[model samples]
Each structure stands twice: as structure tokens, then as C-alpha cells.
Target: MSADETPQGYSIFRDTMADMTFPEIARAAERRAVVLWGLGVIEQHGPHLPLGTDVYMPSELLRRVRRLLAERGIDSVIMPPFYWGVNQVSGAFPGTFVVRPEIVIELIVDLIKSLKKDSFARLFCISGHGDALHNRTVHAGIARGADEAAIAAYFVGAPSFFARVGIAADDPHILPTHSEVERPSRYFDVHAGKFETSSMWAAYPGLVRDELLPALRSTDFGVEDISEWRKGGDHARAKTPQGYLGDPAASDREFGETMMAQHAELVAAAIAAQVGAAR
Candidate 1:
């Protein structure tokens, strides 16, 4: 677990988990002060990215962060990903697997409780979805649950304590870019937007569609502000109407790599704060 033995230098998820026995894994967890709990969803990420995009991003980020921890002689393990979240928007979409907010809180609380029983002390939840507010609330729920158990918990969000020194709140699109693949232009696609498209292109390039973005129409819910940005707004009809938010016409791999690098750094710094020698 020294500074040079980080999982970032090598791929952990891609590698087999069989290498470490239960005792070995538990031993590693006992020696470490922090555990990263990834929360993602099996919902639509525009047409460009796979339904598993949410799951992949956090795991990838953790891989890099682990590398940094190894550099600092701090060892942390990425817990199994929790793939269910509040996904009301993508309910109309084929692959969307929505979980009620209450369920999210309870299930996460149970997971943390179980982990605490096993000797892990601190927990961090890293999530991605349309429900930022809901996710933050869920984070709070986990923290409260952990507190009841006398453990600490936090969320790795852009504006939270883990903020990267130079990263802007609006820089590098948070969602995907769902349009064309070549020479993509930056469009106002927030849901099925260009940023998401670029990210999907980087992670699962074969899943993206290069044409048919301009024809999409906007799906405005009657509730205006309240319903517009939610998962129920218009997920199934992204290509026909407003299924996505950003324009995916200009997405490319280069932008994806840059975003990944930045995101990984932020994740690493956050994990460092948790696993660094000081704690």
C-alpha cells in the first residue's frame, strides 16, 4: 500500500477479484481509513453512451484515484458499485431502471451499516444522475445513517469539500453529448447533449450514433421548471423531441480524455484526503 502500489498504475476492475481472499480483502479494508462507495444507475445516458455509463465513470475514476493513494502509501478499495438510483426521467427509456428515493436511502443505509459492521470506518458516495438534488439528499441520508452507527460519510460532488482547485463548476459538461461523432460542435445538449456523447464515445464508442441529432424536438413538461429537467421530462423520445439536453454533433475522443483526466484528478484528491497518511 505504499506510494508506489496504486491501482491506477494497473487496472483493478479489469483484473480478477479472485487474487485477494476474503481475509486478505478484509485485512486491506481494516488497514485503510476510507471506502469509496460508487452509486450509479441503469438508465439512459442519451443515445451516444451505454446504459452503464454512470457505473463506469465512477469506477474508472476510482482506478486512477487508487493509483494516487498507492503513491501516498495509502490503500483504499472501491466497493461494489450500487447501480440503482432515482431515475424518474429515463423511465420512458427502454433500459432505464428507476429506484425510488426512499429505496435509495434505505438500501444505501443498509449497505453502509453492513460495511461498518465489517470494520470500515469512513464512507464516500460518488454518484451520477439527473437527480442531483435527490442524490445529495441520499448522501445526507447515508451520512446520518453512518453517524447513527458512529461512522463518517461524505459525497464527492463538484461543490463539496472535494472540489478540485482549478476546476470550474460549469467547465467540462457533466452530462453526455448525444449527437454525431465527427468534429462535434458544442451544443446546448445537457441531457442527451454533446458532452455525454463525447464521454460515451470515449468509453463505449461503438454505442453512439453519428447522425439524427438535429431532428430531435424539445419535450417540455407542462410543469415548466419543475418537470422540465427531471427524468420524466422526455427520455424515450430523445431523438424525436427533447430526450436529451445537449447537442451531440461535435463529440470526440480527445475531449473525453481531457474530461476523464480532470475528473480522475478530482476523485484522486478527494480519496487522498480520506486515505492520506494523516488520517
Candidate 2:
């Protein structure tokens, strides 16, 4: 990927994966390179947002991160966003496309195998879809593959790397005016709320239904599964009928820009730091 080109002008993630020669990939891996794979879901986001909110936001963020990583001289590739994920809560909702946990795990494991076989030293699963079940799958898949497949290779989550960057050390509320996130903001309203909405605005403004955002509100809420008015398990439709748990009115684009930049910088820096350490 060339820096002279804008993020919008950038080609497919598959192109990056296919760009390098086997020998070149091996040499880079021997020297400790990092490859980033974005994880997200194609699920319902309320009336105000598109189904691909998770994928769209992270695609833009990862693009910015790719540039930052390049500036730090890190040999990194941002894989295409992985949309097939376990969206248990949203499954009963009309637009949500949910996958079983084990299926997600197996796919991640296969990806790890492919990257390792091609000589990528470290694999960073940078997820935008933050479901507990999905997170567990990605973490476990990486752990299992790195342990049994490639002993010297590294596989881990982008969150842990963000922790190393320090901003996400304790769930800070990220500021919209600047990169300063308030303490414990990360812990608050993580589901399809302001963060997701404003993020949709920042990355793909045309896709967001701004006028409809005012009408979308849900007072009844429970962080735990409340079943989408369905049998056995609770879902997004139950706790958040509109499929959003945060304040859509508060999804400030200014804050979103700051948040995306902060995330990109932290992710890039963390990868560079870890690659340096591994070397």
C-alpha cells in the first residue's frame, strides 16, 4: 500500500494479501512484521444506521491505522473486514446475520493458519464487533493456533494491543473535541449506541439516516440477554427495540473523528511497539 494514495483510493484488502512474494513475506516475518485482520458483523443497526455499521466504521479506522503503521515503518496488511460473526442478541432482529460461535472460531483459526503458512510473524485480530461470544471465539482461536501451529509466532486481539497503547487502560470516555477520552467511558454504552451511530456518521455519512435518529429511542434496557421477544434467549430487539442502547442524539461526529484517530494511533503504535519487542 502506498501512502501517496488516499484511503478512498486504496485497493482491496485481498490485494494487500496478494501483493507480497513468498520470499518477501518470509523475510519480513523473520524480521518480525505484523498483519492486521479486521473483525466486524453485518447486523442491524437501528433505523438511523445501516446494517454494515460495524464493518464500515472499522474499515475506515483500519485504513487510517494502516497509514499510521506505515509511518512507523511497520510491515502491516489490513485484511478485509470479517463480517460473519456471532450476533446472538441481534439474530432475532430482522437485519442481523448471525453465525454460530464455533463457526466463527473455526474461520478465525483457518485465517491464522493461512497467515502463518505465508510467513506473517504476528496476527492482530482488530475487531469492531464487540460481542462477548465473538470476542471469546477470536481470542481462543488465536491462542490455540499460535500455541500449536507456530510457537514463535504471535496471535492476539487488538484490545490487548490498545491496552498497551494506554488510552484503553481503564475504559476511558473518549472526547469528541480531542483524543482525550474520559475515564471509564469505554465501560459505558458499548453496544449499538452513540459510539456506533456517530461512527457511522464519521465513516459513511451518506449511509446514516440523521433525520430518523431523533425518533429512535429505547428507555427499557438490560445489559444481559433479554430475548428479542423470542423463545429461549434474549436479543437486541428485547432490550433495545430500536436496536440501539446509547443516545443517538449524542453521536457527535466531532467526538467520532477524535475517537477514530485515537484508535488508529493507538493500534498502529501498539503494533509497532510489539513488533519491535519481538525482534
Candidate 3:
């Protein structure tokens, strides 16, 4: 689908909270509409992709999720994208904007509180960025918000994130995928590799610099290399001088669409289960 085209039955103005008026929002809240919020970061994603890749990817995924929810007879509200997130690993890159972890936590807490004040009870925080610290901070914020505001808040993320924080994959606050999205370059495509490049191409082809793909080589990193890159600053730059990992040339739009669709399926299923159980 093109950027301007909405799905057959989806209406952005009616479903998106940011586009709704106070009365509409109040009505949605009365109907127990679930809120879907996309969390991302402004960071470099190699030479070929735009810096807003993180924001764009999750925003697109959430759009698909919203459509899927509508089809399942579920009411939902999509929040405006939140891209000001912590970017610790890629902070060395020029386009990266690293917010303080405490600030991110505070911002998330405030957002949740505001939603509660507006009578929103259930929130799903879906993030495109996978920085361990960033995920942890967001989780912390959600926890605090749920406790203080008495709202049902969930952090939808990968199993790796839940594992990293020592939280069970099946935790009540977490909606993790059953497994990682299967792809040929799964291991090496850590950063702006084939997976991300293709995803951007499929969703927003105009934003991607396709011409640069042919000339760019892959920067596949092993475990040791990843450890070095995680150090940030000079270490990360030294590990990925070109500011990307994996082979962009290997990206395929079809694979991107498949991967995103699979993810949306998993996320939509999880959301449906929660919504049903609540009823």
C-alpha cells in the first residue's frame, strides 16, 4: 500500500486519537478503546536509509495493527508517534539523538498519566528501537504509570528484551512474540542491515536511497564485534565506520512486507487476547 492510501475499512481520522476531538476521545474511552502507541528513536541507520527509520517502521507497523484490530471488531485509538527515545548504542553517529534514560522514563510516565486522566485504561507501548537500556527505561515508566494511575499498561516487544531484563516472556505487562521473525540475515542484520533496509523500502520507498544500496557493502559483526559496538562512542564507530551492519544489497521488499505482516499478526493476536480477557 502507498503512504497515502488507507486500508479498505480503516479511517485514520476516526481511529487516531491525535486526530479526534475531545468528545470523540471521551466516547472512545467510554467504549473501552485500547490505545496503541509507537515508541522510536531518531538515529542513524547506515548511509542508504533515513535517520527516522526507527520512527517510520513502528508507525507503519502500528497502522497495520490498528487495521487488524478493526477487522477483529475491536476498537482502538492510535496515539501520535513518540520518537524521542534513548539512543545509547548509536549515539556516536551524527544523526542520533540520545535522550537521558531518566528523561525517557519521565516522559513515558507523564504520557500514561495523561491518558489515564482522559479515561483511557489500557495502553500498549510498542517500540521500534531495541536498545536494552531504552527498553528497560520504558518498562520502568510503564510500571510506574500503571501503579500510580491504576491503568492496564503493556510493553509489546521481542523476547530478547524481556530476557535481557530478567522478566518472563509471559509476564502480564509484556506481549512478546512467540519467536524472532525468521530471515536469512537474522544474525548479522543487527542494525541497518537487509531487514531494516527492506522494511523501509516496502513502507516508504521514497525515503530510502536505493541508488546507494549497490555500492554499499555489508558490515557483518560477530558476538565479539557486537560487544565492542555496544561500548558506544569510538568503539561503536570503529566497529561500524559506515554506520550500518549487514548487507543492504540483500534487502527485498517482499521479505520486508512478509516480516512486518508476521509481526503484526503476532501483536494483533496478543492484543486481541488481552482485550477479550478483559471483557
Point to the candidate with the largest lDDT. Answer: 3
- Candidate 1 lDDT over 1-279, as tens digits, reads 211145443222442223456797688667854676667787776554567777766666666666776777766677777787876556777787877777787887787887788788877666655455456546656766776777766666555312322223442212111221232333334455656666656654545665654454433323343344553636335432434655556566678766666676666665566445345
Cα lDDT of candidate 1 equals 0.59
Residue-wise C-alpha lDDT for candidate 2, range 27-144, written one tens digit per residue? 7677656767677888887778888777766677777877887787876666666888977556777878878888887887787787777766567656677665665565566667
Please list all clashing residue pairs in model 3, or write none if there are none. none
What order do you get sorting by TM-score, best first?
Answer: 3, 2, 1
Give the winner by TM-score. Answer: 3
Total clashes for model 3: 0
Model 3 residue runs over 4 Å out of place are: 4-15, 164-170
Better of 1 and 2 by TM-score: 2
| Model 2 regions more than 4 Å off | 1-32, 151-188, 218-235
Instruction: Score candidate 2 by lDDT.
Output: 0.62
Overall lDDT per candidate, in order of appearance? 0.59, 0.62, 0.82
Q: Residue by residue across 1-279, what tens digits does model 3's lDDT show?
A: 645344532222333577778999899999988999888899998889888888888878888898899899998889887888888788988989989989988888888999999999999988888677877787888888888889999998768768975666666677776666776754567678898888888877878899989988877677888888888888888989988878898888888888889888888888888789888
Instruction: Give the per-residue Cα lDDT of candidate 1 at 186.
Output: 31
Candidate 1 colliding pairs, count:
34
